[model samples]
Target: MIRYAPWKVASIILGTLVAILLVIPSLLPVSTRESLARAAPWLPARAIVLGLDLQGGAHVLLEVDTPSVVRSRVEALRDDVRRALREDQVKLTGGIGLQAKGVQLRIPDPADRAKALPKLRQLAQPLGASLTGAVSDFTVNEGDDGVVQLMLTDAGIDARVRRAVDQSIEVLRRRVDALGTTEPNIQREGNDRILVEVPGLQDAQRLKDILGTTAKLEFRLVGDSGANPGDVEQLPYYKASEGSGTLPVEKRVMVQGEDLTDAQPGFDSRTSEPVVNFRFNLRGGQQFGQVTAENVGKPFAIVLDEKIVSAPRILGPITGGSGQISGNFTVQGANDLAVLLRAGALPAKLTIVEERTVGPGLGEDSINAGKRAAYVAAILVLGYMLLTYGVFGVFADIALGVHILLIFAFMVLLGATLTLPGIAGIVFTIGVAVDANVLIYERIREEAHSGRSILQSLDTGFKRAFATIIDSNVTMFVAAAILYLFGSGPVRGFAVSLGLGILTSVVTAVTMTRMMIALWYRWKRPTVLPI
Candidate 1:
């Protein structure tokens, strides 16, 4: 058997006893709890409670509605295509993009295809020039006799998906941020789905409801300008609003918020009026400047979501790139407007597939259960190590203590919120980590029995076992990382903590433990081991 000096044996035993002592206060009063939270923050072997998956809670999966989003975008494209073709005097018959493909038209004569195909491509110019520049991508394939076909490209569909997904993600982020919840996990699932998990959320329905709706706002000019009186000769650049909800009747807007660079709810420094201040970009500023300059002293509507909110006559050129919007708004109303403006308009609708309430009561019980399991598992591991290896078990336990410290320090550094599954992952990790120590100790015993000296025995034991430990643990860590990348919510929690544990375990069990043993051997030079 391998030999350890009496001092080395005593020191290992003493250190483990002290670590156990340090953990005792967590069972005591509130004063002790606060003290423990701050003590030795780097390697807290303390048990951190987890979420429902660890203790016991329901798991929910969300499916994104992609078809709905695609249809909405196609419909909008159809409208734009029709309007542009009519404006260009292209006699187009039948459907637009949302129909068979992107666009379709029955030419009056076969020769019309020559002029129509090229012009239709131009009409679809807003789609982008890169794809349509080539006739093959834009396509005018002859149908049997003479009918030509136009179809949307795969690249165009991919482009639309990307835009829709981006818009959905931005809106979701706003809704979640406003909830004031901690560590809510939200991520894009596949090309069209969004995955979100809120810990300690008793009622998740409200969040889902808020996220699923496509709240869109649009500004459109309405009514005939002929009936309107005032500056018929001057052509008052501002049109009066003709609709409702911030959109003024008989007035036209000089500029809309889409051209804005930023919007925020704030009080006017001079007047203290609750208002939304918006600033336009360079191009938008120029457009606004031109519009206001042309319509000086003429009415203009400030519209939001197809409704006219304000109608004010243009005074002069607004070239400062910024302006204030003040209405009969409370602070909350202004804040809401700011939020809506910042989030912009949703590109496509989200249809909810699943939603459920996760009560706080359910969450608390999970925390209690996860903590209990962790404590029980830790005790079992400690007992097994001591009983199996006798004195060397104490050394393994010390290394394990170091592993726990590094793991907690890592979690705190990353600001990772620990769920119950995460705690279970840590518990499972301890089992794997302890196995490495068992392998090393058995190797050490083999070397000692072969009549090697104590120093020589340890050196050979660590060296022989190092390769196996590194290779096995590294492979497992890789698997966990892959799962975390693809898995949602608690599965992700499991992967993150498990992966972290592997790194911490390798350092403590092999390097740090060996250094301590090597240092002891140099000073003591003992002849026999306690085990």
Candidate 2:
């Protein structure tokens, strides 16, 4: 135990030095740490981030509007069925309409039903890739009365809901990240709800406003279908008084925001006003150019969430596929619109069923309480260890300190969040850290009483206590892993700290303590152990 190789000693020193460097910055003020990062980019930049429970921010539970999703899907499917029938030239019309679970079309003639059944079955395409080619999004069924029903598969709607939830989570993450919020927790709560916890967020209403809007931008032509030219779709604009005070946009969308490649907030050089400049992707650009070229003198509406943001006439063909949305918006509004366009629209509407805000004062008090508890635990553990054993106890205490520093260092490296329960885990680690030392010291006393030499007894004690330490720590590690796998939120955070502390404790207690003892022994050349 006393004869450590030169490289091993150097490695231990390096590890301890690295831990000090990484952990010290976390204990410093934010400004000071930022300055240090600027000065030395080589050092670790990530610090311990406080969780929502500790930092205090916004908490919102949003329920996905599944009914809206279903209705939209049904309407789109109904249109597809009508188009398919027209293309196939299977004429037996009562017109396609929505039913309880899907769409239904009346084929009045019984003779035409056979022709339409095969064509409608052709429309029942596979939902996605399948090895068996068994499941489809829709099932075509023919009734005795020649009424063909195109019913949506249960699997398809469930799949759609799952996709919507996943896409919503990603979009929410992008929106929150755009707001410069740190370590926001966005997760799905159930089949139809999402839970969002943002740390250090100040303006909850601003975030809500951003999330509330669907931001589904569409470009549609303004025209009338009948001889008198009746309005196609009446859309709302930002103000109630823009071009007849209502948007008379054709329901047929020419282009959509999904085809957008980029959107930036900028000022129009001619008007010196804030505007949102948007560029379309290749397919979108081609379609946009084609539409503008066809309707050179017609007005087109830019609709957002059923509201028209702008209505501009095609003065000329815009072949470049880039345009600006100018609605006399302020700089901030333009920036926000640009962000919304860039993030894309949510799949469906989200209703904030639950909203919560944790005040900064409560967070500060929680932090102080955690700190106090930790300090008290450390003081008690250190005092107990020192009273039980003399110089050996001091060595254990030093190792315990190093163990904690290393834990913080690992936490920083992993970018783990520290919650209130995680603080409790750290306090719990204090006692666990000294367990190995106590085992080793007790074993050493037993060996010394058995009449072994001081050096021999120390070596034998470490070797004998090693197995017990491994068994205990491994069991704790397994428990932590189980907790992490099954638990959520704060429980996961606690598992992280506890698991990391166990590993760090083993190294510090077994290795660092032995190293210190070995070095002290070499200097003192004592015939008897200090303990």
lDDT of each: 0.65, 0.87
Name the runs in model 2 displaced over 4 angstroms: 125-138, 225-231, 239-244
Task: Give per-residue CA lDDT, model 2, range 231-331, as digits (tens).
Answer: 38666666535344675678788998999999999999998999999999999999999999999999888888888778788999998989999887889
Instruction: Give the root-mean-square deviation of each candidate in angstroms.
Output: 7.4, 2.6
How many backbone clashes does every candidate have?
Answer: 26, 0
User: In terms of TM-score, how similar is model 1 to the real structure?
Assistant: 0.73
Off by over 4 Å in 1: 1-101, 119-159, 174-182, 198-256, 268-273, 296-299, 307-317, 326-330, 522-524
- Best model per lDDT: 2
Residue 92, candidate 1: Cα error in Å is 4.8
Candidate 2 has its poorest 10 consecutive residues by lDDT at 222-231
lDDT tens readout by residue for model 1, 1-531: 134466765765565555455545434565666676678555443433344443232223454455655556555656665675566566644543245445555655556556656665664433444545632223444564435455666666666666677667777677666656555666776776666666655555556555654534222233344655432111212223332222224443445567777778899888797988888889778877787777677755565544445455668877788776666568877876766666665666666565555666766677678779888988999999999876578877878876775666566557566777788888898898788998888888898999998877888889999999999998999999998988877788889899999988897788657756766666667788545
